[model samples]
Target: MGWVTGVMVYFVVWWTVLFAVLPFGVVPEEAAERESGGWRGTPRSPAIVTKALWTTVVATAVWLVIWYLVNSDWLSFRTGWLAMPA
Candidate 1:
């Protein structure tokens, strides 16, 4: 894959990884009041820094794999799924 394609693939992979890593290690806050629980919109500790770090690492690895597949002759993305059988 070219530099531009690699970068684009990495960008998409980064965002995908971010969403996947966002829910890891999430903790819900306990409510003090018995009648009505205070369940806020945000998580107890979002851990943005940790999540971002993991996302970067995961995205890099995923991008490398995809880049290799596209550049290598082992796989061909141009092959059509609907092609008629010989």
Candidate 2:
């Protein structure tokens, strides 16, 4: 794949990884009465920076694997492994 395509793929992968990583380490806070009168459970510390770092790491790894597969001759996108039923 071209560099631009690779970057796009990586971007998509990064967001996907970020979504998957979001719920990790999240703990529901204790129920407390809010002035707004709505019960919303939020984690005490979301640790967004840490989660973002982890997402980048995971997305990079996954993107590398996908890049290798896309650029390699072993797996051809033109002629896929499974034959589509007519």
Q: TM-score for every candidate vs. truth?
A: 0.75, 0.81
Count of backbone clashes, every candidate in sequence: 0, 0
Q: Which 10 consecutive residues of model 1 have the lowest summed lDDT?
A: 77-86
Give the root-mean-square deviation of each candidate in angstroms. Answer: 4.9, 3.9
lDDT top scorer = 2
Which candidate gets the maximum TM-score versus the true structure?
2
- List ranges where model 1 is wrong by over 4 Å: 32-41, 77-86
lDDT of candidates 1 onward, in order? 0.81, 0.87
Over 35-66, each residue of candidate 1 has an lDDT whose tens digit, in order, gives 56456544778899999999999999998899
lDDT score, candidate 2, position 67: 95
Per-residue alpha-carbon lDDT of model 2 for 4-59, expressed as tens digits?
99999999999999999999989766775587553569776799999999999999
Query: How big is the positional error of residue 20 in model 1, measured in Å on the Cα after superposition?
Result: 0.7
